[model samples]
Target: MLTRAQVDENDTVLITGASGGAESAAIQLAKARGARVLAVAGESKHESELDAGAQEVPIRGCPLQDQLGDNGVDVVIDLAGGPNWPELLNV
Candidate 1:
């Protein structure tokens, strides 16, 4: 995500699919850098923030898209930027 998003202190990263290891690590580092980390994932994966140090935002259906609006995200760490990504991007 840094390669593209260029994460900064004021950036807020909304990490979809928070259960992955690499993305989880990235969220942790982003938060440590003083960025607000909103870890979005399925209800079952909400407990992961204990180690990632991110504020868990459970998406019963589509939480990231729900939180995101017309403007672009400061940084989006999409674990699976496949077909479902458009839903979040449209936000």
Candidate 2:
């Protein structure tokens, strides 16, 4: 999906709910493909998400929203599929 979305080197990719196995695998895959991946999850799961090859972004207080500004994201691998869904649209 990342490749289909044209996620290349230096492109930003966001994958919500990184605590799960599928999400973690997606994070690793995105990283291996050279995309800068942001794994969104709870603060407690940040370390595990990072270990899966993604930069951490807490769902509660997502700094990425401000960091990405109006440019938004190149691609999103949404595993959470909840309220955070709309929020991920901006980053």
> What lDDT tens digits, residue by residue, belong to model 1 across residues 1-91?
5646667787877777777888788787887777777776767777775467776464737644555544345776777566667666664
What does the lDDT read for residue 13 in candidate 1?
A: 74
Highest lDDT among the candidates is held by which one? Answer: 2
Question: TM-score of the candidate numbered 2?
Answer: 0.81
Per-candidate TM-score against the hidden true structure: 0.74, 0.81
> Distance (Å) between predicted and true CA of 4, model 1?
4.4
lDDT per residue (tens digit) for residues 1-91 in model 2: 8768877787878887778899989988888889888777887887888788886465546566775566666788888787767666666
Off by over 4 Å in 1: 68-72
Which stretches of model 2 miss by more than 4 angstroms?
61-64, 67-71
**Whole-model Cα lDDT of every candidate shown, in order:** 0.68, 0.77
